[model samples]
Target: MGINDDASAGQAPHADALAAGNVLNALPPGYRLQEYSLDGVLGYGGFGITYLATDHNLKCNLAIKEYLPSDQAVRDGTFSLRPKSPGAAEIFHWGLSRFIEEARALATFNHPHIVRVLRFFESNNTAYMVMELIGGQPFGEWVKRKRPLSEADLLAVVRPILDGLAMIHASGFVHRDIKPGNIHMRTDTDPCLLDFGAARKLVSGKGGELTAIVTPGYAALEQYHSHGHQGPWTDLYSLAAVMYGVITGQRPIEAPARARNDPLPKAVAVGDRAIYSEVLLRAIDWGLAPAEEERPRSVQAFLQALPRADLMQPSSLPPATVRADSHSGFGTLDTALTTQLEAALARHLGPMASVLVRRHSKEHTTLGPLRAALANDIESETSRRTFLERTEGLLRGESPSRPPTTVPGSRAPVSRPPTAPPTTVPPMFDPQFLAAVEAELANHLGPLAAVLVRKSAAKARDRAELFLLLSDHIANTDQRRAFIRKSVAAFKDKG
Candidate 1:
């Protein structure tokens, strides 16, 4: 019997309501597949359509993934699945069986972060994998709706995902595709790794053995070549790309283009290193290294390179190792030196000033470089003098007056009423003001700076409004004031 001409297809009287001319070729809502009723199309991709479904016997919601490779098949006016060309049938069935095998393999997994497959079956000349209908936002949309994830938040989300990847790797499979869209964030912020359609048996140096599918920006260069040695490092690159996207709000350039002429900037160089730990940024850069051997060989090693929990605690805690070589000309400093430097800088800059100072020390090992970097993040001349004096004292082995009790991004109790929003609207015609805003924003946010400045400028009614909107981008109070001071000067110079 032709797959589409099955008796089950004819019995679903209300199936047409859901399937009514949907281009994805998904069975309409109310269409029965075994004991489950399709509710609607939850999502569709190049390889399949995920349908929100109800298991009538169990009376529970599920997501059903129907394998329909778009390039090789089409649904005609009669809603029948057919190969685009007669010659494609042999290849189609081979892929169809592989899809079924993928479902079977995933059905054995029970990890929290890995999407669970309940069962697999054949229908409509294709395969379907039934999964629990997970409730959460995709990582792509999560990043859009929420604020940029700090290094701690990023690690919290990705660590569990790496745990899940470890299981898949142990099962002797490579999840060839891992990207923002394939990751879902639960309401409580736990992450689930989704999509295994690109997964293949862990085989190396074999051409045409694995499916040639990849998400461009997230795919490693090896995945591009059929004979490329695919291994754990393949997923490692994509996972790092996903984390890179979370912090920077943009994917690294595609691996192919990068192989030819890599214009990709190191994560530390992309933005203010203070906003994110140098360790986290460098780890991401290492994960995204073009060559597979250069990338982290294992998930555990990658996770180890990230900032630890202790680093995110109150500033009074012992200093966590911060790599200073790339960010500042100085090599890595011992924890004591770091603590002393932070303590001295905090004295002059503010409670949160240590973050900015530490970041400055990374990019500027010498006093001159340190002063230049600090000049952009510090505003008052007196404060600047105090900073210099404190540095001089620290260099001379003087003790820090007192350590900051609070972390840079931590909130303090609100004892006083919030300040009123500025009412005086400034003219919108100042180019210098906008340029200054972008420049300051780029210091922390990297390439996303221009995009954010434009977004803030659009909502701004006046110069005061613009300042208020952009100020939130800078996490450190000292840096915010410095940005405002410089931007205000731009308007004055124009006058």
Candidate 2:
């Protein structure tokens, strides 16, 4: 769990040590674990203790979660962990393996909204997982401070979480715990999903019959049973509960209780209409369904329930001062063009792409300027360039390539001259040639190949020049050389 500055709430550096029932249990400040030095306790729970640590090699602060399992194990005199009883040893070791598994699984994901696990290793007869230390407040604390948030403001936080959670589900894991406390609000106001201690992998799309590890209001009814059929919907239910708390300023009725009498009020009935849209409220209600089968099966279904317009209405909320320049001159966008631009931008920006495009589209009506404005939002020069190249056709309001005029002696096809306008010229390569090159490059660079091919094509005057330019994007020397050979051979076959 990431207990940020605001979440600690004025606790002394060693507060968590006391909270965990033993000061001696926590590694004292300046205790070294390889390159990291334990500074103090960040927070501790039944499963483990998180420490504020300094990475001597990196010269930065990070959080290290130690698999303490306070109920089964305790710190010995020599600062090493040992099981309390002979029977507890099996349970403690099993839990340690699961904790390490959690670290490995989370480390594979690089999503902005997921807490990053840097590394994990065993030390002092226990395992430790090093994680990026977030510098803001817990979602629960942040919500208290920024209460009365508008629909747009609330969705801004909710959307990123859904994005991260969707990734976790797609990868076959359920974050059994999705309470506000597990959601970290970064200094930049971005939300990150944290505390994967309760996360478990699903087998054949269903979670195994394990012990019920759940938060009261957030957990779905399925999570309340040891042999319950838990899946993605389980996480959605918890996420919806968090939203319910944000909207109603109170936690919804617990699942076990709801399953019996079902007295919990619908979000649509309780949420203030003036502050929140009916569609948004209804989505929350649907997500909070007592029965897992009754709730939205996946994140996509839940997202569809709350349409984009309902979530991005600027009029009902305060003006986005940071985006004031792009929020003016609101105009309607062509449906096809809008979808195309959103898909292209989504490749670079992930789930937040649509939100950004919608905000910018309100100002620019034309594709060229709209693309330029969106490109500026991309922080990376490489990504921005790739986005511009990928959408070059959209900028010109036409297909990326046209029919090629083949040269008589050379294999390389010459560009056809435009018949409609003297100033316009066809692309240097045909659509088939570009697609072939993109396909070949995809073997090395994945989806980024298409954008790189388009960028190289714009600069290359001939087939040889095009292959040479495309090779620059590939870092591996052998692979780059191999790509050039394959590309040239493919061009010959095409000719």
Candidate 3:
């Protein structure tokens, strides 16, 4: 879950007493769960509690979400959650199963824009989900500090989220909640879509409908009723409402009010035309339509309706003098060199490497500044240093230590010098084993796992060597050990 801003709102009478009671129910600091230690409560809501925790095995921070469902359940003297009433037990258990299902489904997604679920387990008569702890402010708070953002800046945030949501929709899920507080903005990586507690699979008829969970001013009209028709258009409405809030500094009129014939101002009319493009504003209006039928039907349709040319333009770079290298000129850099650099950087970053390269290339005609700029985006110091060393060799016109691989989205591989053939060709591992490794690695590294696994498999001589090579990509000592142990066990079972 992303950082929640207001957990205390909508509390029943005896709010203070309820808060203190809930604290007693929460896990105390230093309490251990497998490899993780509870540090403190990050936030709580009607559904569950999210705790800040340290992964003792991985030696990093993470979040643990416990299924309490405060409205229908409570912690007893033994600290195990039981239904508040005998009648509620069935509903409570049903919700618990849904929570577990959600964790399993989320674990399979390797999208950078979606919050990554690391592990899930059943415990204490309920269930728990361990997720990557995001280190950034909520998009709601970010907008508070940096309102009146340029159209380009807003698209930078919105485009990645739409891409992630599109993936979720294609996988048969709908993020029922898409408020500003649920979007996390990271300094080093792309913004992430968070708080999937309200997410549900796209099922037909009444059997598929679950209890309605909504955020006011952001939710679509269909979300107000349990049996109302909902799909991709439902989420798009909430996202457009978020955009309306970002541009006009206030959330649009809540959907129910608009459904009652109350006026909701158009985004185009409210926003400054000079600062924001009419196409973008009108697209937002189209998304904010009270009737789901009136809204853009899909993410692709919504994206097509928005301004596109500006999104492709590189973000402006800080002014710097061009370096003295003859290859450094005032115009675009050499196409071949750019391709080589993108391919090298992609090994460290993922597919986003090309976008980052293009974003910086317009201003950085010189190799030195461009490399430095790209390195800054990398979060790990070790990875950044390694990237610099590799690119430094490339910029100096030196032959790579190994053969160049193909860059994603490119038609051909980066050209390499001829070399003597090796005495032995590395044997290929079973396809099933490779897929298992990729899935396991994705638990830790998200979307980058596939790329890392493919590269490591190419160089590894055997199953053991392959696991060892892939383990290097994981920074945590205990996690690497765990990954290797699990992979070996899996390989032995297959054999």
Candidate 4:
């Protein structure tokens, strides 16, 4: 849409008009503000009015953000900016100085995905920031026009934004407010990060007053408290929230509410697993964690958590062969031994293991063929070994030496406490031992390596079974030796 000079025509009335009127204090058409001429209003944000203007000298369109804190200031009939009350003038000028500082700081950077500040100057007793007018709909509007985005499309838009965010963070500033509304999608599909006013306060540390401006569902929990320690991870939280919105066509539950009760469903938990990879979905969930430390510490770490496009193609999507047959209703394996095998496989394959085991059971009922198929599904030799070690005896009808005592994904000891009655106790699962296995496994397989340990540990009846399980998942002799040494240390710790 072309910019218009009419104050009421372009900007929507603010929802809280009494507190902050939605009207843009548009300068009259042809009115000159130094090198630029007023053209129309772009939009109103909590801190400023972004106006469409013509750069007279440059002969191009520009977006000028007017430092008009609607709550503290107002425009008279002649369009002169003034504080609402005598007591509010100090706060208004303070914010004005921050707005100019934001413009000056942004002018020094030149990144493709970041907004470019062209100039900044005082106009009508207020500060104005002139930026190159970006061409594209706001990301929120784009999402509405395009309901659901593909994995490729989502990554294409987000990666560049992350790259830009990384640079911003490297400069020692955080984009505390990162939401769909501030993300602009160019016609070429490049995403442009917008609105540095909120971030500017944080960067400049002006007046030591917290910005307190936040968009619910996008702001990290720590942001709610002024004194809370916020860093680069805060932006990562909002970025993940934006991804969640893109995938589900819905905003996640607000962060404050999530702390009391995390009612918001994960991207995978909400039926997005079919379209998105578990790694990507998990990364999104990980980034969205309420606690700051629980989230990815940096943009690079978050990027690493995402599966590469090439790897995602082959391993992220569940294999087509695992689908259940509608007519026979026998697509899954459920024999007690097979059940145990499926549990083991699920640690590696995520939710797909159940389907795969059942399909393999129907096609390769015999142990020999079934074992071969299972091995083919596993990517690591160590993981394959673990699978065989657990199932070999089960397939041969050998009774387990002891009852299973370990819980999947937990390292807590399964053995009874020394103070407890011995009769009620099963066996113990040593947290130290499981922790060593997970740490060693993670070096080779990333975070999911722990899954291999948890699944294997859960089925072990004794130390022998546990050793067999660990050996199966760690094929390298030196790595196996290292694990053994760590286990020995753990055993000593328990003793």
Candidate 5:
């Protein structure tokens, strides 16, 4: 949504949220300003203010961050490191270098563990970043909530953090401060990582400025050493300390001054077996090592050390890879509809289908049995969105994922189902609609297909089932009828 949506979406976001979506939408084109009033202030940095804002567009909670010169921006004249904000308008111009550079840099990163940037813009002397709002408290708060993670859970959290870090590291950036505050996790399972405010691109060995600043407790000894340049190993060291705090319930203040040459991880002893495992301890030790050179060289190396954990279907993760291959293969499109996608795609694409397979695979792969059996029924219907504006009544009755539908003017199904005799008579299949009638039919039932389909609506009321039957009947094809019939069959089976 534009800045206006950010601002005036009925209920206000957390006072800290960026004035709901109104502010975000109000922003001039190509300009954004997100304020962190969401969930109260998480924290602020030298670069900007981060707020947890409600995203009216996505209809999900979000952390909307606005980038303006930190207090430091006023003193410094440069744009990025040692950058200055000349004045109100000047902050925009002075901060332009960092605003654009950071936006460009953030765009390159996309991972489940890594916080995703939803959108970006700059205005009113502030640059804004719209980001995903994750559950669970930050690491420090997490420590207070759960005391410390169980060793297995600790491993779960650590591996993905390293994985995310590895991605950033692969991009040639070092998370200068890998502290507990920056390392966040989801409560249940499959905890991921967060925060990259201190991330720095390691280009031309200019990261020397990072030597001046480091995350306390977690920072590697080399990070504090002005003379010693650092690398990815520095982050590994800090992450280890975070591990120490999570399992041992005590943060490691510092590493041994003279780290030993035994570069690989060694077992760390924790008094409570209930809290930790030998393998996990070893992983921590390797990460907590003093020398950046001594820690695992890459995030991949650390992931290899951790247990073989599988990434589960995220509660909100979308299957980027979509298909419509059901039992009946895609045939010629209905004169009006395209066959590019069909209900069967869900079965064919399967659960194991990697939405990003083509993106990450070295060798082109085909859908497999394991994947096929485990299907992902990712529907691309947009009915509620389209109908929500014309008649919000439709939204209350069905799900957003359901397909589009229509009201028939007559009993007979035909390409042109005779126009409405009067305003009272409803029409059938508004081809102008963007949503699919089939998808909407299922959504209208709210997954309770068995009972709802039999209960017909008042003939006057427009509904998904009515439109679906009319469309299928009018198409005058068994295949068309089978589409809805199969859905009914699936629902019955589920019951």
Candidate 6:
């Protein structure tokens, strides 16, 4: 709360209130008009005006946003007075509800990367919220001055944006409108995501269709066209697009031009000057997919699918509590039934070709050409399957030892690693590793294949890619999220 002493209380109302038609200065008789001295009017949107103000109560400089009921439709050239539609009044009511929700939604933000709401009050036709004023320039401006930010700088700023989005999603909200203009960076280059969160909370609590949606460039197609189908993926899509713009100067579009077939829009090959790696470039492509069902299902899944080098580094996998043991009726089958069951699975999953490879070596050691090719594919597939199986076993292990890692002069047997230190160290992001893990996870967990493709795998937010990969193996949605919530809480606890 950046409220200065003189700004909070004991100040004369604006003398120009009458001239400006400041409907709020005479806010009800007993309730006085609060004057927060305006240092600068930052910007105005269709919804309301935002000003930089000094607050006395909080004794700090703050950004005060007064959300006035939007009369934007009249000015936007969309709605008309000619004829009332089936739900004209209903639409108006819904829009008003959304506006309120947006205000309340703003109030819910408590992250360091987000602007904090110090106080919220209603007067006349608007809602006034006092928030922390971040000293930063718009991302658009940063791009203008700094041009392509260094990869490290990109992460310093972008990571927090992902974090803020995840935080918003965990609270059951979506920042459907994600774009460069919506991102702000402090003078220090610490990026703060702004105006990215959606304002749908004021609508029906049970969730209803939105009449209007976010802007086109960064907005997910589903957000606008799909009726009442809003979910975490919508925001995931938009965020991926923002990342795309950050990495590649081009505004990422969803339509694929076909270097590779990805669900989201792939970053156009901008060559060396491109700010992101191929993994990130590919991740962006996945997130910008045209359809909701075609996108990653959750933010976590989106994180996992991101391209990252950390995927190759030995990292602690999420807790492995849910297991195949959860499936009941695991009695040992008769030997006859065991053979039949194995045969069935073999036919279904494509036989463990290693068995054939072994049999081949024994049966025809001298076989050439056709037999060699058959055995070669079988050997390769077998190796991949074996690696995937070992990983699955490691993931299911009950012990919390260190994850298996290839190290110099380490004689100990390869076993799953212990859980990471519970300190609040931020993650080391690697886009390439993220992509590889996603490819591996998709291979290991077949039934939950869609999880790998969740959100914008093809869009390239490495952290989102990691989460997507994790989501694929986890059993229960509630449980998977609970793990992430606990992890964040663990860090917050340390902090």
Worst 10 residues of 4 by lDDT: 1-10
Q: What's the lDDT for all of these models?
A: 0.64, 0.69, 0.70, 0.64, 0.45, 0.46
Task: Write the residue-wise lDDT of candidate 2 on 1-495 in tens digits.
Answer: 211222432112232323333543788878899999888877665667788888999898888888887778998888899999989898788777877887788789888998887888998888998888876667777777777877777777877888888899899888887777677777435988776766777766333665576666778888877688898899889889888988888888879899867999989899998788766787898899898888878876675455354235658555533222233232334656666665666555443344445545655666666777777766679978887777787645654232223332332211211111224343578888889889987776544566667877897655555665565555444565566546534563222
Scored by lDDT, model 5 comes in at 0.45
* Tens digit of per-residue lDDT, candidate 1, span 16-107: 22342464566766778889987776556567676778898998877777888787887776655778887777767878887888788889
Error of 3 at 14 (Å): 30
Which runs of model 1 end up more than 4 angstroms from their true locations?
A: 1-22, 76-80, 204-208, 315-495
Regions more than 4 Å wrong, model 3? 1-25, 311-495
- Which candidate number maximizes TM-score? 2
- Per-residue lDDT of candidate 4, residues 1-495 (tens digit): 111111221122122111123355656556788888766566666677777777878788777778777778888876789999988898788778767776788778889998887778887888887777777666766666665566766777788998999888888778787887678777536888876756643445543345555677788988886566677889999899888887877777778898866888977677376678665777788899898888777787676556554334544343546545443233443355555555555454433344345445645645556656666666568877776676566555553233334435322222321112224334677787678667765654456456556766786554434544454434333554454444433432221
Candidate 5, superposed: residue stretches over 4 Å from native: 1-40, 54-61, 67-71, 75-99, 124-126, 143-148, 205-212, 225-228, 254-267, 270-275, 307-495
Q: What's the number of clashes in each of the models?
A: 9, 0, 0, 9, 41, 66
Assess candidate 2 and give its TM-score to the true structure: 0.62
Model 2, residue pairs in steric clash: none
**Which stretch of 10 consecutive residues in model 5 shows the poorest summed lDDT?**
1-10
The TM-score of predicted model 3 comes to 0.60
How well does each candidate superpose onto the true structure, as a TM-score?
0.58, 0.62, 0.60, 0.60, 0.48, 0.52
Higher-scoring candidate on lDDT, 4 or 6: 4
lDDT string, candidate 5, 1-495, tens digits: 111111111112244233323332222222223332244333444444466554544566666555544444332232222333334444345345555566668766888877776667654444566667766545555556655445545556666677677778877788676666555555644555554544556666454544233544666777665555677877777777766666655656555443555342333655365555444566666666665665777665554444333222233223345343343232211311111111122222221112112111211122222122112222323422332232222213322234324212222222321222233544543442313433543332222222223332223134333433222222112333344344333421110
Score candidate 5 by TM-score against the native.
0.48
Ten contiguous residues with the weakest lDDT in model 3: 8-17
Judged by lDDT against the true structure, how good is candidate 2? 0.69
